[model samples]
Target: MSRIGKRPVDLPSGVSATVSGQMVEVKGPKGTRSFTATDDVTLAMEDNAITVTPRGKSKKALQQWGMSRTMVANLVQGVTEGFKKELEITGVGYRAQMQGNTLKLALGYSHDVDFQVPSGVTVTCPKQTEIVIEGSDQQLVGQVAANIREWRAPEPYKGKGIKYKGEFIFRKEGKKK
Candidate 1:
């Protein structure tokens, strides 16, 4: 048995978790989110918490049991406090601006890159080069941030590009003749 799988995900007041078929729905004061359990993983809600159990002792069951447990936990957290991701634009001419629900980024490119903010997520530019993305769903927030950063990932030489705040970009030394 997986230690993490055996543990219960405590639900705070006003939070409710429901398991239906392979889908787990977590509703709270903030919002509601749902996730589907993987194969061979059984989810049960009790004591205002969630317990994940595997059907058998097979390797696949064990692997999915832990994964499904964590996924449910994340969904619960998402409804409660949510998640956030911050990105920093580093370059001479790099910057970002929020136009309504769209984000415009200038990453030293000839043309600017425009990205639309998905529902349930908010993008804010505190500074010209700082971008903050916030949402309840961690996976969606992360994926959206990644898509924005992918436009111009930080380069190794000058470390000038789009990167996550506090992210370390190892610089490669030039050839010393």
Candidate 2:
């Protein structure tokens, strides 16, 4: 038995969880988020909460049980409190700007990199160096941050590039003369 799967997810007031087709939708005061669970996992709405159960006792089913439950738990928390990720540009010429729902990143590249912000996600830049990604879906917020960081990952030589705030990069030593 999975310890995580055995735990029941309690639904707070004004929050509702439902299974629609293969997807599980979690609605809360903050927002709504959904995810398509694995085929072997079964989702059931009980009282004011939801339950995840495996179809069989096999290893595969057991493996998915905890994962599916954890994903559902994250969705519930996301819809309730939302999620955010911060990014920082660490270079002399690198910067970021928000034009409406689009993010313009100039990371020492010849051309500017433009990324369209998805619906239900908000990107805010207090300063050109600081960026914050917010969304009700934890997964979506994380994916967006990763995609943005991929545009110009931190370079080892100068340790200059786009990276998440508080991200650590080991600096490489230059060759001896």
Candidate 3:
């Protein structure tokens, strides 16, 4: 039995969840998101909470049970509070700015990097060194942030690059003289 799968996901006020077969859809103030779980796990909606259970006593079924429950919970949270990621540029000349729907980045590169923001996800540069990513889909928001960070990852020595706001970079000792 899965501990996490045993707990039910409560639907807050102004949020509604519908379960049809293996698919569960959640609609909230932010947006509506749906997920289709594997056949090993079953989905049920009771009152204002959603629950998940495995079909049989198998390893795969048990594994999916917890995962399915988490996914459903994420859906509910996504539609309500949504997801956000913040990135901070750390370098002398590194900064970020927005031009219409494109994100212009200056990361000490030869040319300014231009990142096109996707439809569902919104990218904002509140400050020259800060980048804010927000969206209802958790996966999309994270992927967009990762793509932007890939342009210039923080280095261990100088720690100069684009990285998450709370991320830490371990420094290495310089070569002996």
Candidate 4:
């Protein structure tokens, strides 16, 4: 038995969820999100809560049970509170700024990197060294932050580059003179 799958996802006030066949849709003040579970799991809505149960005792069904439950939970949270990711740029000449819907980054490269913001996501640069990504979809927010950080990942020596705000970079000693 899956502990997480057994627990029903409670809908907060002002949030509503509906399940039709293998698809579940959640609506809240922020936005609406939908998730489609595999046939191995069944989705049911009752008493302001949604539950996921395996269709059979097969391995695939059991695997989808817990995953479907978590996916439903994420849908609720996404429509209610949304998701956010923060990135910090560290270097002598590295910086980030928002130009309209585009994010301009200077990571000591020959040419500045221009990142076009995708729909349903908002990119903001509060400070030259800070980048904030916000969206109703958690996966999109994380992916956008990762794409920006990929340009200049924090290096082991001196730790100069872009990284998550609270990320830690292991330092390496320099060669002896």
Q: lDDT by residue for model 2 over 60-103, one digit each (tens)? A: 99999999999888988887888999998899988899999899
Give a tens-digit lDDT track for model 1, residues 58-163: 9999999888889988988899888999999999988999999989998887898899999999999999999999999998999999999999999999999889
RMSD (Å) per prediction: 1.4, 1.9, 0.8, 0.8
Q: Give the Cα RMSD of candidate 3.
A: 0.8
Top candidate, metric lDDT: 3
lDDT string for model 4 (54-85, tens) is 99999999989999999899889988888999
Candidate 2 segments whose C-alpha is farther than 4 A from its true place:
20-23
- Candidate 2: residue pairs that collide: none
Write the residue-wise lDDT of candidate 3 on 39-157 in tens digits: 99989988789999999999999999999999999998998999999999999989999999999999888999999999989999999999999999999999999999999999998
Worst 10 residues of 2 by lDDT: 13-22
lDDT of 1 at 23: 93
TM-score of 4: 0.98
Candidate 2 clashes: the total is 0
Consecutive 10-residue window with the lowest summed lDDT within model 4: 74-83
Q: Candidate 3: list runs displaced more than 4 Å.
A: none
Q: What lDDT does candidate 3 reach at residue 151?
A: 97
Stronger candidate by lDDT (2 vs 4): 4
